[model samples]
Target: MRKISPRLIYFFGALGGLLFGYDTGVISGAILYVKRTLDLTALEEGMVVSSVLLGAMIGAMSIGPLSDKFGRKKMVMFAALIFLIGSLGSAFSPEFITLVLSRIVLGIAVGGASALVPTYLAEVAPAKMRGSLTSLNQLMVMSGILMAYIINYAFSGMAHTVSWRWMLGFAAIPSAILFIGGVFLPESPRYLGRIKKFDEALAVLNMLREPAEAQAELQEMKDADEVELGGFKELFSKFVRPALVIGVGLAIFQQFMGINTVLYYAPTIFKAIGMGDSASLMGTVGLGTVNVIITAWAVRVMETRGRKEWLLIGGVGMAVSLVALAILTNFAATGIMSYVTIVAMAFYLIFFCATWGPIMWTMIGEVFPLAVRGVGVGFSSLVNWGANLLVSLMFPVLLQHFSMPIIFGVFAVMCALASFFVKRYVFETRGRSLEEIEATLRDRANVAEDDSVVAGTTPIAH
Candidate 1:
């Protein structure tokens, strides 16, 4: 067999992300037609949108332990296959309930890919390239989103009976590609070492690293395994608790910042501002383009400039822009407000794509020790999807009951709080080896305990 290049591994192995992006983004457009076709109420529409998240939460929980046990390669390919099945099932669903069922099935693949893809990238990557490689997962996600936006706009012109079906069916193509491409990838060497396949792990590592470097990394993996392989209990230990909080907190705040509210419902927002269907979808396309471009640039510079700085920038940018957007929506309600909303959204997405959008996944991949990377990411992802579910499910209802300004005002506040959390909690992981990060977390946990004990001592008030 030919040796696999790191480039192929970086690109193709992240196929799961591409499938995830396209699958999720396509629904935004599909729902426009599906809601009309079915004559659905707002709650029913939210259910159609959020059912996938419910599946994703369950899927995120299930896939981690399985990947840790079966290997990342197999599980990723499995997700691709499941995604394809779900896409086809969704396209053919005769009614709303059936469509929701299909979306939940597809959501499993989305959640699995979300958790596993970055973990795979982190494991194989040299410390220097880790952030960039993991960010490619985010890149593919943005590309998938962009691809979906274009498709949705193109298909919107079709007859109503078939337009949404075409939009939904388009997801199957990328799912097929991911399934086929994932077959050619190697298992994570860390995972192999965890299973005691020493020789095989070394063999795979050799492909990714120079002979000397490969052996060194293999040793590191062995050491990591000894640090408590698949140690779920270890995650809550004092030494590792902060890492868990950072991971889960980042996940929750990422969603609460309302990036998905924009991605999943940009067209709806545009429409409310007086744009027609074609124009609103085009607005999404513009935003999607920005997402891809900004994310691409962020990953390239991530290791150079660092994740923490960009996250702070994103926090400030999102909060300001969302507040601006909220205020502008009122102008839109009564008068022309195109430039204001577009410019504000552009700034908001630029910050998010650069920081939280990609950095969140990149950090999650690095934050956990090898022993619990899978489960830790899974837990974080569950929070992410759970937050996503709440936001998507509530947007329509909120719109019906509250003003756009108030809803986005809430998002802006969350973004500000999320920023504060990042400055206080999220550690910089741009160029650090996963093992180095793990060691730091372990040390921190130890120090925290020591601090507690010393505080309790008091020396009899002497």
Candidate 2:
């Protein structure tokens, strides 16, 4: 095959992200229509909104091993097929249970894509451009969010009750495209090497790098696999524990900070702050717009600003924004803080877009060695989706009983802690190759013999 341009690889990667965004975000608008059509209560609405997350948790948990064993390309294609089935199933569901089931199925696809697409992109992209290329996943997600919002707006006012179904079924279009596109794309060179496909791996490497560099890259990949492949048990081993800590911590902190809570509940948050239903829905479009713009900015800065710095900036900004939000919401009954709450949310999102949003995904891909990369990312993502379900499931209850002030305050504290953790433990990975990172980790754990033991076998007491 002729060498695929880096640009082409990025294009397909973003296309995959587009499907992810559409599958994940389209439900936001459909929830209201489905609720009314199905005669759903508040609890049912929560269930409807969270069903996909349940599916996502399962999907995220499984995709890692499947990707590791089967290759990223095949797993992604399978995810696309799942997405297609889920979209069609959801669009034509005759009952609420069916719709929820479809959403869960869709979640599986979303979960898989969330784990695999960025990993594939990072492996294929040059280290210099890895941040930007991986970031395209976020951009595509935003784009999907934007597309869903527009489609929802267009369909929300339609006279027919079936309009919402159309809004949702539109996701299948992108899912189909992704599935077909994935069929034509090459598998990750790293995965090929793992399976001992030396010649094929060399071919992929040559396509991804200069011809002169392919042999050396293949050799490095082979050398890195000399150690035992990582498993669940390896997660607790001395060599892998730090990476696991970072991965799981990143996953939990990302959700605990309440970014998805805002995304999933933007309209409701706006309505609670005194905006009318129509106005709140329109305001959500603005949230999507800002999310897209800031994510674009993050893509530009990901490689430029070191990862640790961005996490600190994002953490502090998220905390400040959330605290401001809490204060605003606490007094929203007076109407004075309503607009302030909106602005605070906007700031919170901006900070997330700049830092935690894209960087978390990028860092997850970089932090683990290849042997355990799939499992680590999968486990972390399962935690992320699981946390997503917990928060989404409980946000309504918390809103009703605890008030927005307490809820957002909790998130702010989490954000503060997350920032501290990132600053203290996360390494700067800009421009570094994966092998170099692995070498650094290995060297950090290497044991040095004492001079007395090495020279004469004479022991000295301290």
What are the Cα lDDT values of the candidates?
Answer: 0.86, 0.81
Clashing pairs in 2: none
Candidate 1 per-residue lDDT over residues 1-462, each given as its tens digit: 347887887788788888889988998888899998888999999999899899899888789657877889999989988898889999998998899999999999899999999889988888988888899999999999999999999999998778999998888888888888888898888888888888988888888889998998888777663644555676676666778999999999999999998899988988888888998899899999999999899888888877888888889889999999888987734344685788788999999988888889988888887777888888889889999999999999899999988988999999889889988988887767788887887677666667767889422110
Instruction: Give the per-residue lDDT of model 2 (tens digit) for 1-462.
Output: 556766776777667678777776776777767777889888888898889999989988899768988888889889989999999998898898998999999999988888887788878777787887788888888888878877877788874469779988888898988888787788898888777888888887777788877888888888774644567877666566667788888889999999888887787777777787567668778888998999998888788788888889999999999998888787734365666677789999999988888888887887788888888788888988898899988887777789888899999999999988997778777788878877766654442225446676554221
Best prediction by TM-score? 1
RMSD of model 2, in Å?
Answer: 3.8
Off by over 4 Å in 2: 225-229, 333-338, 447-462
* Candidate 2 clash figure, as a count: 0
Residue 54, candidate 1: Cα error in Å is 0.8
